[model samples]
Target: MLSDVFGDPATIDETAHLVGEVRLIRTVSRAEAQRTTRFVRHGRA
Candidate 1:
């Protein structure tokens, strides 16, 4: 669960509440992050 593109704290909290958990991390590139997240999300990583 990434939060950088989530925008605000309230939105983050709302997402967490609905989605169960959320985590934030620093990445050099948005594309890289998206790729990693997508991989993990599909349980293929």
Candidate 2:
């Protein structure tokens, strides 16, 4: 199963996997958290 999913080495500890998932979630969510509700492009016709 590990080979089918991860392939090659396919050997990560539970803590490492959890940390990777948390990092990815934070990275993906950071853009949304830092975005404003309005567009800011002006005076450029």
Candidate 3:
């Protein structure tokens, strides 16, 4: 189960995995979010 592999909340490895998953989702949702919200793009550009 991908969620089981990535959703454990007690290990650093699991936290890192979950963060990566969250980043991917955030990147995908940025466009939609942009339609109604403003965001600051910071970091290596």
Candidate 4:
């Protein structure tokens, strides 16, 4: 299955998978939290 998805070893492009940095926030404002409250109740944004 690995060979079927990745193809040949020599032809694979490694640079295509470098996705840079990912940031995670620790806090949010009251308005921002209220906006997200509806999504939690209705299962959508």
lDDT per residue as tens, model 3, 1-45:
656665655565768878999999998898767744543354322
* Selected candidate, larger lDDT, 2 vs 3: 3
Highest TM-score model number: 2
RMSD of each: 12.6, 6.6, 9.4, 9.5
On the 0 to 100 scale, the lDDT of residue 14 in model 1 is 90
Q: Which candidate is the best by lDDT?
A: 1
TM-score of each: 0.35, 0.46, 0.45, 0.32
Residues 1-45, model 2: lDDT tens digits? 666665566354664688899999998788655553223344332
CA lDDT, candidate 1, residue 15: 76
Q: Which segments of model 1 are wrong by more than 4 Å? A: 1-3, 21-45
lDDT for position 26 in model 1: 36
- Global fold similarity of model 1 (TM-score): 0.35
Error of 1 at 41 (Å): 33
Off by over 4 Å in 4: 1-28
Ranking 1 against 4 by TM-score, winner = 1
Report lDDT per candidate: 0.72, 0.63, 0.70, 0.54
> For residues 2-42, what per-residue lDDT tens digits would candidate 4 score against the true structure?
55776875434442333221112223455578879978889
**Per-residue alpha-carbon lDDT of candidate 1 for residues 1-45, written as tens digits (9 for 90 to 100):** 456789888998897776553222233466678999999999988
Off by over 4 Å in 3: 1-10, 32-45
lDDT of 1: 0.72
